[model samples]
Target chain A: MGLRVLAVDDEADFIETLVKRFTYRRIPVTAAANGPEALARLDREDFDVVILDMRMPGMDGLTVLQEIKKRHPLVEVIILTGHASVEAGMQGMSLGAYDYVLKPVDFGELLEKANKAYERKKLNESRDHS
Target chain B: MIQDEFGRLRLKLIAITLAFSFVPLLSLGLGLYAKFYDTYTDKIYGNLRNLVDNKKVTIDMFLSERVAQLSNLALTESYQDLAGDAYLERIFGVLQLHSKSFLDLQVIDQNGLCVSYVGPYQLKGIDYSHEDWFRTVMAKGIHVSDVFMGFRKYPHFNIAISRREGEKTWVLRAAIDSDIFDTLVRTVQLGKSGDAFLLNAQHVLQTKPRFGHDMFDTVPFPDIPRFSGTRVDEITVNGQRSLYAMTWLNLKDWLLVIKDDPAEEFLPLYRARWLLILLLSGGALLIVGGAIFIANGTVRQLIQSDREKATLDASLTQSSKMAALGKLAAGVAHEVNNPLAIIMEKAGWMRDLLTEEDIKASPNFQEFEDAVTKIEFHVRRAKDVTHRLLGFARRMEPTQENLDVNLLLEQTRSFLENEANFRGITFVRNYQSDLPHIESDASQLQQVFLNILDNAIDAIDKNGTITITTHTVPESGEVDIAIADTGKGIPKETLEKIFDPFFTTKKVGEGTGLGLTISYSIIGKLGGRIKVQSDEGQGTTFHISLPIAV
Candidate 1:
């Protein structure tokens, strides 16, 4: 199967655009409006990589990353930002986010981060199962 | 504060003027006193000597005439006729008629018996034998005696001539009144307080003073040479200062003393001295006062201009620094504007492609649309920033005209008002209604306010405050506007260089460092000054002063 993924942000348009693009590229995708929707989606599915916006209305990207790490220890997260709080995105990676991408991004560059995050998640899952 | 400066100037003026003028003032006082005193003393001496010399000649003539008269009588009269009372009375009466100074006449035998007396006193046979007159005439052929109080009990001197008859000696005697001699000497005197008196060889007063004392009484005679001429000596008599003009009369063997109080004698001279001192003192006061007044006025102007120049130097430094900053900002903003425009157009093109039919029908069309939208949005945002940079780079020469600074400030305030309100910031305005209009470029002045007020909003947190005030400076006749903000202030290290180009406290991409730089050049071109005052935590105040007319 194509890499399983969840894209999280408060910009519904940005998430909608991301889900459509990922589906066309043969990557299976899901979307969430905020941190709660993101965590709920994580609880039901085994996503390989989680795409997250660093700034949101409530439960910022870093805090949501902590919750994701506790529940799904094997899943990889990639941070997206407008550079408003690049420091927060950096902190999120140490908390187990796979990598980060700047907003208004080059499409090719973002696709590469997602693919790298998926490999790490799969590799961690195999080790845990073995 | 002004008092201290004026006081120093006053003292220096006084000291310098006094130094140059006091010596002459003092010399004039001494010279005037000396000149007048010498003149008065010389005049008194001249009068004294003239009186003494004139009186001496008269007295000498009187003595010689008397001696010649006696010698003639002795030669012409026989002893028989001179001894006869009738003949002797006739001759003596004739002599008395010529001068009333003669007192008595007598004829005495050389045996010391009074043979005849022809006078008021009864001396028909009074003992001439024991008297000095008889003994003096017997020893010398003729003699004039010293004054004595004889049997008559009055002061008189005798003139006598002795005649020889075979073996008998006959003496003819005459008494002269001392009053006539006193009258001759007493006529010589100075104006009140000055008197000429005669002192004899024995230091006895021969002629009494016009006021008091007997003829024979002693007088205080200074120890001068016997035949001294008119000489003036300063002496103290009865604890009073006097000018003593003295001369010796050789004919009468007496001293002529003219004693007078110098103050009385030189009263006019003393009065002159007092007047001169008063006049000089008045002149000195006038000169010193004028010097002080001139010094105070001149020094005050110098000090005032000195302070003004210091302020001007500081303003010049600020202007040059701002000029440097403006040039830098213009260079930077110009370099960034073209690339920013290209990026904006490219992002818009990306958005257009996402709306194409083929792409719209595709499953991934929505993702492409979102991506392009984000790109275009950010690009537009960056363009707004580049436009501000372009504004800085395009700093133009001021097109000056009359402007209401208050209105310009209000329009700039409106631009940031919404953001301020959303952040819960308050606006405090104190507008002076009578503020005069200033000549300035309105658009440029408005841009300056936009730069400063925008900075205020970014610097402050929620619930902050900004105060705007405008007034006319009375002394300078200039318009002043003060804009203050409650915010975390600039640091001490950055406050001086705040107007310098490319100096900013904001993050790199968030701030282009050209806002204040452009504003500075605009104000400089309009002939105005911009200054800032701030403390680390107390926020900042920007003061702008503009010329009312130009």
Candidate 2:
């Protein structure tokens, strides 16, 4: 199966841009514009990698990221933010976020962080199954 | 230069008024001398003319009256008795009674022999035929002699009368002293160093003090013709040029001339005129001073206003420059953040795909994992840097919350400890016991600690030690955090500028120089203060003070 990715953002333009970039990279991608939408998507479909915006309208990205970690511990989550605070980065990472990226994001660097996070998650999952 | 416009103008006015006050005094002095001297000379000339005319008329009337009286006496019935040898005393008394002005008298025959002589002569029966007046009287029966040398060499003018005595003519002569003429000439008062003289139609000095010696002397003729009207003439007399006024004494057939050394006679007038000129000059100086004061005041006001305007303009420009920089930074941050997010997302998917069984069994899976790990680590670091960039650009308002600053310091220390350990330096923490919580943006406080750590790391060599200390004061109600590094410290000159943006000790590309500046701004926004102490070769320490939350 193709690599699974979940992208969450409060900005539609940002989500659309990410979807385009992911499509170009031939990565399987799903997107949500807010925290509730992101949670609904997470409940219906299983993703190998989840990217969440740290600042969201309702049930902020950090909360959704925590829920993802709790429900699908095998899935890796990456947080996005237009205003990337160090405290939020630390908090996200402590809550099992794969990594955090600031907005107007560099896809190449984000891809690398996401891939490493996904590999770590896969390893942990396989390790549990074995 | 900083004075107001009116104040400077006043200064210039004072300077100009003092300068031009004396010009009119000089002109007035010269003008007074010119006018007074001319008038003085003219007055003296008029008086001299009157004296000469008066003397001539008196002398003429005296001689004519005496001749008439004596002729009448000779015509009297006792005339023969008086002519022949009657009483000499009685004759003299009668003649003296008839003519009081005659000083001496003589009677001579037509044959030029003196028959009877009056009192002073004492010459009885003396011959007088060769005398000029005698000859003239005998020939014409009446004669008047010009002034001549007489008794005691005194200047005298005489009138002679002759009458027929049957076959011979009897002549009578009277002599008058020129002293009376001298006295009359003296009465014609001249100005200082001015005098009057009588000049005949031929322009000779007569009836002057030296008239006896200079009776026939020629007058010192003027350079220009003497004005016939009541006007003055400037002339040269006795080798000196003087202002002179001349008038003809018609009765005396002489000219009255008055000469004044104009320079002396007008001296007082000149002095008074000079005083007036001085006053006028003072007025001119006042005008100039007023002008200068006004000019200075205007120029000063303009310059001061210009200086103030320039200062205001410079301040506005500085603020605008800062504003422009902030906007540029924000725009740059917004553009950069989106791309970083995509990179982090795609990298995770790749890492997951590579770890699948099929990919892992492939010979290149191990290579892929290593490449992925390297990319991931660096990508994570780049994301951190970008996050800091955005934080600096957005200028986000601080959401201060009550937090334990010691805990935050411990967390930051834990983060940097591993890195310091790799560099052979040990990190030490000095947390104050019973530290209080302060209101602050926790993450920004972390960034401030991190920036301080970064600067300390750059300053130190291997084996350098960094110590972090935290303290709270109950009395001051503030928290203090001090980070000290036993490393090659910053130079003293650059210590103050350490927190200025783009000022750095590191070489190009190694440090952005924005770290300390951003940290300073963050601390400032939190209502805290940061201070540094350092010695060039010893160590450096940064102290941060924060007020306790109310």
Candidate 3:
């Protein structure tokens, strides 16, 4: 696979735009709006990395990241927040997120962070194989 | 319930105004009495002197014309050379008619023999050389005798004249009755109980007063030197005080004396004056009473008005406090929500991972534990903040309970120490070890300490020291806790209203200003007191004293 990524957002337009950007870049994108939906999807699917928004309508992005880490321990989560509050960012990192980013997302930064997350997943996979 | 400083001052003003109006009334009463007495005394003395002078002038006019007519009749050649009984009779008749005040008229020859006599009992040839009037008339040709009992058994005075013409001498005499002086005495009318009398040159009473006996004998004569003018004197007459006024009848040499009983003469005026005084006194009393009544009424009204204003102000303050509490609640809710979301997220993550038996056996439990610990920290932080917020927001009602005052203080200080450290403050605790337990609500006392601590921390910029000391005052049955800070002090203008709700120096979103208001209310409900001492550029100190737990 070129790349396996999960993009999470509460806003439909932002998620759609993110998914299209990933698709054009020849990367596979999996998406969920909140924590429960993300956790439900994680049970049936395997992805290289998970992207989640910090603020959401219900079962916020941090909860989704937590659920993703618990279910798919090998997968990496990149946090996306609309307002870059220092305390919120700190909270996401404390939750074992790979990295945090602000929206409207910078595609180059997101691509780099996602690439880094995918490499980390590959390293964990290869280590397990050994 | 609202009788405060302003009401007490208004009551004092009413009392002062009531006292102030009494002085003028007393003065007015005294003034009226003085005026009335003065006016009456002046009138009585004025009229007495006028009548005496008029009588003297009438006597002088009669004496001068009679002398001139006698000389003209005696000096005529036909009348002087033929001096017969007929001639003499005509001359005597003219003299008698001219001097009606006289009692007898007589004529004597140059040899001092009675030439002619007229009137009731007269001798035609009686020898008159032994008489003083006869001898004086022969020598000076005109004579007047002192008052004496003369012919016709009358007390009289004589006017006599001698004439010489063609070697023949003629003497003419006219005796005036002493009772003629009574005319002057009788005419004087003193009001009500006053008397006027006539006295001779010898100071003998000539006429009796209308009231009784002659005052000349019964009354003390003033010991003034005999001077020829009007005089006023106060004398005691018949055991009563009297005003004696005298005027000399210059031509007749008589003393006109007026003895007036002052009380009777001025009785009407005095009584009127007394009535005026009484009326004035009454009016003054009424005015003073009215003023006192009005002032008292006004003060009562003012106190009522002030109480009403106080009631309105208290209600307004209470509502404003409630509004502030609402805002505090909303703000606290928002602050707490952030931490709650984080804790929920991390716990959810842990919950999902802990379900696998193999994962629990793995060393990853350490990683799970670390996450769980962080989640627990946030949850605890949220709970603490919410608990403090709720305690602060709770309305205070009067409730009594026994409490360990020093322990409560120490616990509060420990609770705030982390916050103080976060603000770079050094909080020192100096609690008395032997303090007695105080009665108060633990929540309310804690809120009071928190509010003071918050203010102390806020006052400091950085590196400030906050010192709290607690002690049990055994003698006063109170526990005093003093919280002091070495920070930028409150300004003088803002310090006065620091306890008032919504009055804050902190900028928007920094302070709600209800901290001290709530603290003050809580302490008041517990029968405790809170006081603040602040100086600009120095620091602020709050002293709280709570009644002993009972």
Interface RMSD of 3: 13.0
Candidate lDDT (C-alpha), each: 0.74, 0.70, 0.70
Task: Give the per-residue lDDT of model 1 (tens digit) for B1-550.
Answer: 5457667876787678777777787687778778887887688667656666677677667766776777677778877787788988899889888888788887788788888878888889777788765787788887776666777787777788887878987887788776666778667656687665667677676566765466777656556677555666787654566776666654345566766667676778778878888888897888777777777777778766754564455445555665676666656553453344345435544664566678789998878888867866776576556445544433443456688888888888988889999999988989897788887877678878888888888778778899999999979878888989999888999887677555567887988666776677667777888999998888899998888986
Backbone clashes in model 3, listed as residue pairs: B102-B175, B102-B176, B103-B175
Model 2 scores a C-alpha lDDT of: 0.70
RMSD of 2: 12.9
The order of the candidates by TM-score, greatest first, is: 2, 1, 3
Expressed as tens digits, the lDDT of each residue in B1-550 for candidate 2 is 3335456556645655443333454455557656775686556556545544564455446545656765665555242454544454466567677655556666667677767666565667777777776877778877766666765266766767677767756776666665665666666555557676666667665676432235658866853444443445567666778766666543345566655666775566567667666866676666676667666767767765764465445435533655676567666665566565555546655775775689989998889888888877777787677666666644433466788988998888888777788888888878886898887887678878988987787678678989989988667788989999989988878887787555668898988666777677767778888999998788999999998974
Name the runs in model 1 displaced over 4 angstroms. A1-130, B1-37, B71-87, B106-118, B123-149, B159-173, B212-216, B221-225, B259-265, B304-314, B321-428, B431-550
* Candidate 3 per-residue C-alpha lDDT over B158-257 given as tens digits, one digit per residue, 9 for 90 to 100: 6776777668677766667756656655666666777776666666565555776643443345544557767766777657787887776544455667
Query: How many backbone collisions does model 1 have?
Result: 2
Q: What is each candidate's DockQ, to 2 decimals? A: 0.02, 0.24, 0.03
**Clash totals, every prediction:** 2, 55, 3
TM-scores for all predictions = 0.50, 0.50, 0.47
Indicate the residue-level lDDT of B127 in model 3: 82
Where is the poorest 10-residue window by lDDT in model 3 chain A?
A80-89
Please state every model's RMSD to the true fold in angstroms: 18.6, 12.9, 15.0
Clashes of 2: 55
Give the true-structure RMSD of model 1. 18.6
